[model samples]
Target chain A: MSRRARAGVESRIDAPAGDGAPGGSGPGWPPWACRLAGVAIVVHLSALLAGVMGVAPASPLERAAMEWFGPYHAFFDLGYSYRFYIEPPPTPVAVATLHFDDGRPDETVRLPAREIRGPRMRHQRELALAHSLFVDARQAKEQTGDISQSRLARSYADRICQIRPGCEMVVWRVVQHLIPDRDQVRDALDSPGAGRFDLFDDSLFATPEWIGDFPCHGR
Target chain B: MPRPLIEIRRYLAELSVSTRAGWNRFFFAPADPTALGLIRAAVGLLAFWSLLVMGLDLDAYLGSGGWESAELAWSSLRPFAWSFWFLVGDAWLRPAWIGCLVVLLFFTLGIFSRTTSVLSWMIVVSTVRRAPAALFGFDQIVSMLLLYLAATGASGQAFALDRYWRRWREAKRTIRAIPARYRKDGLGRAVEPDTPGLPAATVSANLALRLIQIHLVMIYAIAGLAKLQGVSWWNGEAVWRMMATGEFVMFDFTPLARWPMALSALTHGSLALELVYPALIWPRLTRPIMLTGVACLHVGIAVVNPGLSEFALVMIAANLAFVPGLYVRRLAIAHEQPAVRVLFDGACPRCRGWMALLTAADPCHVLAAVDLTAVDVRTVHPALTEAGCLKAMHAVTASGRVTAGFDALRAILLRLPLFWPVALLGYFPGVAWAGRIGYNRYAASRPRDVPCTDSVCGIHSRTSPPAARDRSRSHAPNNATAIQEDS
Candidate 1:
């Protein structure tokens, strides 16, 4: 036989100790060690099988525990508005007209021709009168030309544009006689701008006397 | 009819020898010792890397927010709790970076390999336990294997600082033992006495190897049985399910899945194979078939599974058990020598008895004995005198040198299966002196005419010598005398 083949035969005949004939004792282990090893192997295999089957309770418990220890509400997605401007139109000089609208407390007013700095002009009479009446009755005495209703609306729109670039204006006609610098007009402007905007649908606006009761008036 | 039986016996002997030789050549013939060394180096590097990684954030893997954070049913004993404390004290409590430095030293040096293994295992286990949410089977297998290596004392062998230290100690001992006369010699003497060598540690090593082989077989048998016992595995659907899972879906099992019914049948057959593997190892006819099936199964597992390379390697090692012994001896002779010729008696009863004893002693060593009276000794060895053959046992060494009597026995012992232990005994101080005295005593006790029945003398007596038998009987001491001598 070839040398290689002959050597293979020798190794087989001289099989390593413990690797004796079949049914013979294996290595250093006795029957008991084999039994113990067998049991351990079985248990480990069972556990592995259970894990593979997703039947292991440890998996779920582990996930729950992880979630509990991790940061709370750390990964969820909140959606409020920034008020930009407020404007009051200048007074119109036709019949010294006074227009009262529904207004509430904390209402801000802007005048196109004047700059009222801080509290010096806080709650000023002219701005308040212009905001409440839409046309200032005191301005009629100082006017040298007739002021049409269309001209009053145009002046309001122009003042809104100067103070707040994107502001819109709507005009409302009232049956009451025009009043100049009245306390009622001051009260109407000082209340708040809850339902004072005439651009809103009629159902959305409240009467001037009822403006103080509107929910939107609170700060 | 008698001739055929003799032929059968001869064929069986030859077959046994050939098979063993084939296996030995296949395994050890091309072995690159360097490959084993490289494997050791790789493992060491891996250990060092793991140690470095563990040191970077030891605390992150410990305490309430760490591995201990996860509450496992089996974690109540809290085996890793001590390991965590060690890490914490070493890393956070100690001044500077002593903890990592110490771990790195242990890993690199492989000192206290078992302890390092235990510590590393605990840390890895604790980490895995803590982050059971992670899906890394490779890490788990690596950790477990590392733990096994540590527990099993694999580091005792190679590529460790331990081995280097042992070698250094051995070298120092050798140097110390050198004779002063030899050391002081101005020039090498034309003829110098043979230097005695250190005792071979082969026997103890072989013992350890045997234990490992046994353990390896147990693992295989148990693993096979376990797989066979599972209903899902028996039905083959377990494999299918494993393949179907997202984590295991890397393999394209679509084609196999298409024929689940056929695949399930194949699985059942596999289960049967595994369950019967232990039984198959015994029967000569079935051994080859079973071994082939096992090899294929392991190969299939390797292909279909991740982190099964170690398992495959171990299984292949275990398969070496199937080899026989006579063939191994023949290969050892062919590669290292021509053939071992043993001269023995055919008619002498005592000679036959000794032959049986030697046969059992050196199961792996190739041997052939011829009756000195029946054959011409010169054909095999032209130098062997008939008078020398008749006087004592003789063996020719691998170098074509003749050794006789006790020396011949020692040489034969060296070549035997698992004979390293006995062979190593020959290297002890004054062992040769003792052996020479023993052989002399034994040779002196031999009967001149007839082989004695008692243990005191004679190897064999001629079969048809009635007068010699009568003389032997008369020479035999009475029962009373024998008893008195024993006393």
Candidate 2:
């Protein structure tokens, strides 16, 4: 026979039976196909069950309904609502107490107090947002004593203007040249009148001693 | 007399019966006992190698994302579908693994042989699909063959585990009950031999084979024609330029660049050889020469460009299909001839002078001069005339046939080891025609000092009328001069 004709016959003979059959003849379908189909069904069903369980409700009436028919049902409803607010303390106090060793040169600068407002006050507002606030080296030491803690807190309200264009000592760093006497600074901070001012604690700032100390606490 | 004849008749009857039985066992048996064994061995080896290459951690390769990773694994199922089932069962693994496994099983077990074939085909298809960049020509060819095999029920008969099970079932049925059609005395009957015709399964396998064969021929013909379509191929510089590229150069040809002109000519010649290759297979006269030329080209490619070795091997293998069995026998016959022999027109001064130079150059002393003028022209070659010899060079063999001009040159080169290089020149584009024209010119311009003495020259003189001979003689010298100038 011609090769093409023979090939045609061979192709027909080789073709798998049930290729066109729907639901295929049972005997011809291998057992594995059925097994795979079963596995797929199980996986899909379990995923569906998990999805239903995740969206179920948790109130008394809803819980009761869920308990009775939770397996069959996909969702449950519950009802309630709540509200409230918190207020800031009045006359917030902020002490400025200077702690320096004996015979150390005191570097302090004093200026008339000023009010800061409007969009320009954002810098001070951002500074206040941080737990530890800093001030220029001159002003920190000058205002260290005899400053009411509550009035010191008001200084923050317009303190941003002190750093603005019209303000004196706009940019500064506290540079205390102190002798090495840790006990003296501790005694000054513990004194009864120390609460009146904001403290210029050089030990709290990053310094050689602070680095040696490793961890420091501020009050 | 009755006793001797009777014994002889009995002996002859027994011999005939035994011979018939032997034929039945060897050629017409219902089952190929070794077929299953071969299938199993092939499948097992394929599987073992695949698994070993995979290192039993098929996940990594399958996850790497391409068909090559799972090719060995999938090929194991090329005979049946058992591997495909195993793959489907492990669906949570990477799809490549699953796909490969599915293909393997389908190929192994021959279950829903066609469907599994298709499924395995799809898996292989997906592999090629997912990473076409990694696909090699061999991989594509294998995939195509696999799909064709799957569609054609390659494992339909004795070459499968399915067939074994079928045989086992049939054996069981035979043992359990004696069918009324075959039972004679309420006793179990021997099983009947299968009818003599093409088995459905065999038919399927043959179909796949036929498709492969057809595809192979088309690839060759198309590839050859495509090469011919290019000018570089016609000019013979295609090979040189192709090899000059960095990607193809595994070995440096830098020193050879000074002779780029020669290299370019060789390239153009090679391309032309390839272009006309398909045509050469058609004519019996050219088949051997063309096939040899193709083989040499492939061998050259394999040596110079190892990266193309696979292509060369496949093309060489495919070329074998064009070679008829008779040609192979002819080659075997040709090999018995002597290494070198000189053929010349003894009557022609120019031809004899060239032959003398060729003979003197034979350091190995292998040359044997054969004069066409001295031989019995009719007895030597019934197909050729004496006039034919006068027109061109002729080489006669023991079984004589006039090999003229280019063909004579080819035959001489075929016998000589050193001059084989010149035979390769015949494969060059347009060289054969040029050689023919050159030879005719040389033959026509024979010097007057060489006189014709016999009927051989008489035939040439008679064949051409006086006026035509005069005109040819006048123009022949100019043609010879032109040929020499062109060369």
Candidate 3:
């Protein structure tokens, strides 16, 4: 065999230390360091597993594991639930309209713009903020029977007011733009811009539901 | 002792010893550092890009009065959650951001890498924690990779400027000490300098890769299991729903609106890929197929949703842990070392012979010989004149640095690993000056296939030598592009 092929084979082999591997390890670790590292690895892996399993629909054991390991996960920012596209994505998108006091025109901003063509992360970031507000609203409604009392919604509005210097108050609302089923798509096939079907149809969106209204700090 | 009790005790003891050994082999086996270095460079670049984009609107997302106020963010933090942004006053925010960017730049370049990697990770964590409302999977994966890089401590050992600088310094030091050592020993033989080779394998490198691989498995398994709880995923409508969603959709999938079977197939294929990935990726025979499936899946996701491109790229990069370090090392070399193109006179037989030798020496194909006659010389560089190239050979580096005659030869030699010693010797105090003079004389005497009536020939010789020009060999040069085009 050629030298290159031989080196490749040597690299692949799980030989003992100092066996002339391509990237050879000189000597094995001391027993004390090995034992300490082994313990650390075990703990870290266990914490990671617990954090992942602790999302909704978890078992009792998983929940208990998370309770014990939650602090470590939070500190290191290793607490990923990995619930990506687990369910049908939510149809309703939240948006806020800003009202100005200093003769600036009233502006409306969608969390994720309808047609985000550039720097799409800006849209994703905005979408995350809006989703947080929606979650807060839902939780508040469930707990106190009033979605307007959501603290996150108020904080969001207040922050917006600060961003727009002359803004007096901000209004938050949720608009449902549900995805069309196959039948709906077929029905709208002959409509204008049929290739996009009802993607741009104004009637696709339901009436916006008011979440909250909050006044600016100074004003 | 009772016979049964003694037998049970021996069985337990054997199992304990075997398990401990297995754990040590799995986690502490020495592995190549090139893989970690590759991961570090990629993750560092991504981190830099992430932070740069975030900096575009720093005041809005991270400012004290912007999205999440200081009080609001502080109140929502988990007990141990911390951020430098919390303590920075309004006046210091930009300065702090500039400092983070500088550290991230150094980390990406692998300069002061050990310290920069740690600092870069801390910066990412602080920014992400500071503005929790504006993060996605991209931020999380970058942070995870950075954490591993910092832990490895050998992430800058390969495909790094640090490695090159260290090697150069060591070579210089050895060169300086050679005379002193030779005089002390009074030896007849020359001393051989200690040439740096591939980075040594370390337990830390193995530990980092194993951790990343295990973490990836966990992520995929959990994601796949979580999908089982959704009605759309069960009914195979998940793919259609994602494509139909206006916010995430990139193209008009209305054409596929009537084709539910195709959509269902895609949906089921994705779900199956994710569910089987964690289990199949561990086996030697199945690892390649699993990784390919992941690449295809993530690429499709990115195409369908451009916003998730960063997230998809990070996921693909994380999967590099399963790839062997040797293959990654080859890729690192190919990517890190840019090709040096040597512009030579295709009409000169001596130059073609020289080109053939250079090509033979370059097993890695780092040198590309561009025939001046095959294409417009001006296209390569507007300043390049055919007559000047014919007078003295020229080489252009990847960064557009041009050198001529002996310097060009030195540049080419530096790229060919086999001729590194000769290249280094040429760099000595008076060797290059003498070499340049020798090269000029050689160029003046060399024969060209073109006639002496040509304007370029008049500069070298006032009259032609007593021989007819070989027109047939003039256009037919044996360089990289000639054989393919002519034959």
Tens-place lDDT digits, model 2, residues B305-384: 55445445545544443443223223323444434333455434455455533442232234456554444346545776
Backbone clash total for model 3 is: 0
Roughly what TM-score does model 2 have, to 2 decimal places? 0.29
What ranges in model 2 sit over 4 Å off?
A1-219, B1-95, B98-116, B154-210, B229-231, B242-244, B249-304, B308-487
In model 1 chain A, the worst 10-residue window by lDDT is A76-85
Local error of candidate 3 at residue A120 (angstroms): 2.0
- lDDT tens string, model 3, B1-487? 9999999999999789867866877778776666677778778887887777777778867888767767777888897878888988888988988888889888877899899988988899888888887888899889888888887676786556676556545544543443244332121111111433566777777778888888999989988988988888878789888888777766788778678798889999999999999888876668889999999999998887777888888899888878876665465334444467788765455665566556544434566667665556687777788678878989987777889999999989988654677999999999999999999998877765554555566555533243443333333224322423443
Predicted chain B of candidate 3, TM-score versus the true chain B: 0.69
lDDT of 1 at B263: 63
Model 1 RMSD, rounded to 1 decimal: 33.7
Candidate 1: where is the Cα deviation over 4 Å?
A1-219, B1-64, B67-75, B78-82, B85-161, B168-232, B258-270, B277-299, B307-487
Query: B318 in model 3: Cα distance from truth in Å?
Result: 0.7
Query: By the DockQ metric, which is better: model 1 or model 2?
Result: 1
For model 3 the local lDDT of residue B183 reads 33
Tens digits of lDDT, candidate 1, B67-133 = 2232221243232222244334323533423453465356445566556655555545444444332
Residue lDDT tens for model 2, A1-219: 986996465444332211121111222223464345345434433433332233323356545543444332211111100000011111111222222233333322221111223221121222222212122212334666422222222232223322232332212221222221223434554677654212223442233110001001121
Candidate order, DockQ descending: 3, 1, 2
Quote the lDDT for A181 in model 1: 22
